[model samples]
Target: MVLKIGDARSMYRKFKPHLLMVLIQLGYTFLNFITEASFNEGLNPYVYITYRHAVSGFVMLPFAYFLERRIRPKLTWPLFVELFILSLLGVGFTLNAYFASLRYTSPTVVASMVNVISSLTFIIAIPLGMEKLDLKNPRGMAKVIGTLASLAGVTLMTLYKGKSFRSIWSAPIHMGSSSIHENWLKGSILGVASCITWSMWYVMQAYTLERYPAQLSLTTWMSLIGGAQSAVFTVCVEHKPAAWIIGFNIKLWSILYGGIVCSGLIIFIQLWCTKEKGPVFVTMFNPLSTIMVAILAYFVLGEGLYMGSILGGIIIIIGLYLVLWGKENDEEEVPMRSS
Candidate 1:
């Protein structure tokens, strides 16, 4: 049976956000590996982040110029300041903090920390008056439960491996107790900082889009500003010229993938998503990355998938459903409530 074009367009409109988010998470799964490899090879996290945003800034600048020039909002001093602060919160602080944490700890630790961002964003949103919570309502309860479930699922995935699967490598994924070495505490702290800054970025991005309303232009501005801020922060602490130098290697690949796919394209998509949906809605999919990482690790790295990982992935999916369901119900009620 053939589908009508109008019907297909309707379906696309409905599922576009979900599909884009899944693609973004898949891109990030590779990012987890590439960035870690680059770090392992002694790439400075600060320098890498600076280069990434700078590359992303340039990559996006032309698109913003050609596409958004006619409709773009006037760049007032106030709006420029807002963009600068947003960039500082989004990439300038979060990326460096996250990569710095990655330097001191395993990606698993970082992933676990990231799973809590939805909850953090929800909490921040309430006080800032972006979200409403009425525990008596099932809709509110669903959001609360979903956040808890995701946190539980990620914790389970990170800490437990009930059984190992026989993969192509037939090798068991051994999560060592001592994998997180010296400065583990420091890394944990930094990871937590990244989550907080990232949540703030989401909230701020939502607010910024309301004012500016041009996703591509804002992405370009934020990228350039974030890169400049990160460069300044890096230079203040990291003065070693040798560390900043790079050639055609894994480091360059990491920067390109992160800049082009992750930041340049994905950041623009995320801003659009956050504008269409609320900040919490955009964050609700964070746990899916852990599941994707597990799948990719099994196939690409030959890491064995265990019972805990399987269970965690299932719970994460269920939790994500609850969040989305509640969000839809809330939206449906908004008009009725207002009337």
Candidate 2:
């Protein structure tokens, strides 16, 4: 009985990050949905994101200071610079582009597009010597295949919007009809740009975490720096004082939830997961959010569940499993090889 219990505990330890990340992604799906809804209600993307990062920074600062006080390393100038660059790439550019894209497209499109990040990360990591791509190794082959499959799934999702498999009761919120196709093309471009920057951020975070081992502290610093940068941008871009106003509406809710939950909690969870699992492992779960968003959007936004989306989601899921299996196999082999 003791041996069985020990085995169970070991299994739990091994899979705990995976389970935690799944829950986190589900939360993020809901948050993304809310963000889209807020955008439809005419919330300024710049102001919203600025508030998000600022609130997250304030919320996290005390916890990071208290929790990591003893073990936190000295805040050196070079380390500060690295954090600033990370903030610019990850929080500032990635999110600005993401929110901008949402203004032009549906949440479902944005969510499906994000699945490409896994593949992009894999590709970028290989070039950086952060990931191995040995064709002879089954694990490496699996990673390559998984990346290709994910890209293919995303492409299918973008190109084909087939008949609706299921219809919901909610009314669809239309932004506007003027330059709709052009806006969609523009949004797709920006979405891809966000994915690229996000992928870079994952790689940079993995490298940064090795040097600055305090996850909370690092995240706090990133949020603070990114927030300040975003504020500057907001001021320059948004001349009207009305743009910054947050009243009792979806805008207020978006700021509160985006800042507190998405920025603060989600970043902490992501950093912890990235530390435990590699960046690829953490990013592989993005497709799960795409699936969640699809279902949630259908019910809440009265969006149709299309046949193409269903088929694409299945392919994305298969790719996700393949990448995860490859990573797990690689990790298992490391111990044996070392032994």
**Clashing pairs counted in every model:** 0, 0
Question: TM-score of predicted model 2?
Answer: 0.93
19-93, model 2: which lDDT tens digit per residue? 988988998898876777677676888889899999999999999999999989898899889998999988888
lDDT of each: 0.86, 0.84
lDDT at residue 195 of model 2 (Cα atoms): 92
- Cα lDDT tens digits for candidate 1, 198-261: 9999999988888898888888888899999999999998988999988899889999999988
> Which 10 consecutive residues of model 1 have the lowest summed lDDT?
171-180
Provide the lDDT at 163 for model 1: 85
Give candidate 1's error at residue 334 in angstroms. 3.5
| Residue 283 lDDT (model 1) | 88
TM-score of each: 0.92, 0.93
